[model samples]
Target: METRELRYFVAVAEELHFGRAAQRLGMAQPPLSRAIQRLERRLGVTLFDRTNRTIALTEAGTVLLREGRAALDAVAAAERRTRRAVPGRPGLVLVTKAGATGELLSKLLDAYAAEPGAATVDVLLCQPGEQERLLRDGRADVALLHRPFDSTTGLEAEELYTEGQAAVLPAAHPLTDRPHLRTADVAALPGLPLPRWPGPGGTYPPGPGPEVRDHAQLLQLIALGRASAILPDSCRSHLDPGLAAVPVLDAAPVTTVIAWPPHSRSLPLAALIRIALRLGSEHGSAALVRGG
Candidate 1:
């Protein structure tokens, strides 16, 4: 099916209402209905179950919606990559969560620049939960993603390194003196609710914690005794003077991975990835030493 039809179907599938989907698409309902009907006939399957008051996706509709979204993302990536391929402007755009990757990013960029014929690399710092969307939609060529935190679905990725977690708290907090703390110990701390980060849709989940956009803001909140956080142990290197981090012995280890679109064949991206893997390996021992 054409991308237009796929887009219309996806809208209807997501909204579960033809009229609403048409409005979202900025058109009237009649043609939208016709388009969906034609698509269903061409595909030889019913795409939706419709009634007087509501509509629902059929089993086949569910499958198409999943595959269609991927197809649309691939098309968008192709268009963006092509537009960016201007002559004599060769470069790679790397995205990662701000205030998170820290020294590892610095080392990777420095190492990549030394390679022969290395293209210029531009770094884009974004909030957490945004790197995957940027990479998938072609706003970014590659990204640094942490597993169990960032979703890497529909992307090619390689593990860089893994590090244990820690609970970052106010310097004067009673728990700061402990050699280490468990997740439960951190969770039970009164009046220091963990900061709630915005999800992919940019909305905060329901919680008592203050809404946070990035690590910098979260750290500030922690320093003021308004919040606490469980973050990768590497965060200790960047903690401010008013804050301290105690290892969370039972927290999950976070794995940092370098990811890109699966269909990408860019030589510069390959070179960057190679350097990142090497640096990650070289520094794995050091990261472990620091975490300990």
Candidate 2:
């Protein structure tokens, strides 16, 4: 199917309304509806179950939606990468959530730059959950992502290291007196709700807490006693005096990974990945020694 048709199908499938989808696509509803109908006829599958009052995706529609989104992302990535591939476009763009992977990122850059012929590396710090989209859309050449919190679907990645989680709270809060806390204890804290970070579409999930845009904002909120968060223990190194982190025993351990497009062929990017893997392995070994 044409990318245009797939685009239409995805918009409709996501919105679940033809009129809204047409508006989103900046086209007339009649033509948009016809396009979907034509696509359905050509594919010999009823993509949607539409009635007088409501419309929903059939099983095939669900599959197409998922696959179509991926296809569209691939096409966009190809276009962007091609445009940037012209002569003199050197260096790599590395993206990650702002205020995260602090020490590791600095050390990686230092190590890579010390190599004989490392290219310039541009760091693109973004809000939470934006790395995958930036990487897929060719706006970034690599990413440092945390698993279970960040999705690494469709990207090739190397496991950096796994770390436990800790709950960040106001330094003066009663919970800070405890040596450690369980996830349930953090959740059951009175008056302090976990802040909601934006998902892929840049929308916050339904929650009682304030909506946070980045680690800095979330930290500020915690300092003010308005919110709390369970983040990787590595964050403890960066917490301010006004806040404290207690190990959360039952939260899922977060694994850090270095990720890039599966099809990348740049020698510099490969060298960078090698350094990241080496550093990650060494860090894990050091941790094991300390634990032992």
lDDT of 1 by residue, 1-292 (tens): 8999999999999999988899999999999999999999999999999999999999999999999999998899889989999888889999999998889999999989999999999999999988889998898999999999888887899999998899999999989999999999988889999888887578889989999998989999999999999999889889889999998989999999999988788899999999999888877888767546
lDDT of 1: 0.92
Residue pairs clashing, model 2? none
Q: Pick the candidate with the highest TM-score.
A: 1
lDDT, residue 1, model 1? 84
How well does each candidate superpose onto the true structure, as a TM-score? 0.93, 0.86
The per-model lDDT (C-alpha) reads 0.92, 0.91
Name the runs in model 2 displaced over 4 angstroms: 11-37, 48-59, 288-292
Alpha-carbon shift of residue 170 in model 1 (angstroms): 0.3
Off by over 4 Å in 1: 290-292
Q: In model 1, where is the ten-residue run with the lowest total lDDT?
A: 283-292
Residue 111, model 2: lDDT of: 99
Candidate 1 lDDT score at position 36: 96
